[model samples]
Target: MPDLATFQREMRKAMVAGGVPSTTLEGAVVSDTLPAERRIRVHQNNYRESLCRALMSLFPVARVFVGEQFIKGVFAKYIAREPPCEAVLSHYGAGLPDFLAEFAPVCQVPYLRDIIRLEWAIHSLQLVEEFGNALSADGTPRLSPNVRLVDSDYPILNLWMAGTGQIPPEAVSLKAGGQCALVTLSGGEVRLAALDSAQRQTALRIEAGEPVEGDSLTMLTEMGAVDFHAG
Candidate 1:
């Protein structure tokens, strides 16, 4: 008989794909009505469908951007290669953004990777209870626990807005150049703010714990996006 670890590894493979070794399948508790092979298939189907749904929920905008059929096919391919590492379903598709960077089908849609990244950033922040203190000791504003930075060479913000029905699809221009954004969670809702080059630099500086001075900092403070510390 295979060791426990070997048996578990084989079982995992069986759950992911067919071709379960007869020796392994024989260990299943067989009943008169259902055989072990058929039982494993039922579990495999549910496992695959659940993970696929998790990926779809993680990147709803991406699904809208690429149509249900395309996204489903792409995700099905991804699921076959990568399995869940942990129990948390929300965190399952973290690597998908990088996966898309190399996925051949999306080669023409270069921005899809960044869109997944943006969505992942938002999804990740929702799991955090808090980022950190409100401000640095020196009075420089600091990024909130909920703030996430995403910089993309494509007009991903417009694309995301369009995908979410916030704007008309015609409003997005892929040739409009790159865009940067600060994604934050406010009052339990995710918010996106587009930033110019200078503003992006300022935000980056703050993230690095460097002292920064600018109208962007001041405005963010006024908007309660960042808290100002009195020196």
Candidate 2:
């Protein structure tokens, strides 16, 4: 007989992926309300439902972009492939951006992946506690714990905002070129700012290479996108 830990692991896998395992359940748990398999299914359904809701909360824009039925299908595959490793639901969808990037069915919306990234950043910032100084010894600034930057070849910010119904769709033009976004949360207010050409270039270079040019770094410092303190 499998050890208790091994058996439990296998049982969980079975519950998530299929009907309870064919392996004998000599001492398997039984629910008074239903057979063990049926009871396990109820738990499985609830688990998936919870995760699905979390995903929706994090990526409302993506959900709108893809439509309800399509998002449900995506969530089904997402649940099967990327079971939560963390207990925190807010942290659960960190990989979703990459997952959507590679998911072939979503290719129609090539910018969808970046949209997910933006939403994930928002979701994560709400849960992540701030720490450390936002400034360094060289008078340069570091990124705030709640601050994030992303660049994509699409107007992801406008799309996300419009999808959420926060702004009029007419205000955003899909034909307009790429965008860089600076996301920050301050005093419980979350804001997404569009970056200018220089700022966007600086942000891209910052992520890909080292610090940007001095002037751009200074701009970052001025905008408080860079760290402002050592603590």
Best by lDDT: 1
lDDT of 2 at 213: 56
Residue pairs with clashing backbones, model 2: 132-231, 133-230, 133-231, 134-227, 134-228, 134-229, 135-229, 141-227, 142-227
Off by over 4 Å in 2: 1-3, 25-35, 131-133, 137-141, 228-231
Q: What does candidate 1's lDDT look like per residue over 121-164, in tens digits? A: 98887887764447656676787667788889988788889989
Residue 128 lDDT in candidate 2 = 66
Error of 2 at 128 (Å): 2.4
Candidate lDDT scores, in order, read 0.79, 0.76
Backbone Cα, N, C clashes tallied per candidate: 1, 9
Question: C-alpha displacement of 230 in model 1, angstroms?
Answer: 4.1
Model 1 ranges with Cα > 4 A deviation: 1-6, 17-22, 26-36, 130-133, 138-141, 208-211, 223-230
Q: How far is candidate 1 from the true structure (C-alpha RMSD, Å)?
A: 2.9
Roughly what TM-score does model 2 have, to 2 decimal places? 0.85
lDDT of 1 at 100: 78
- Please state the error at residue 143 of candidate 1 in Å: 1.7
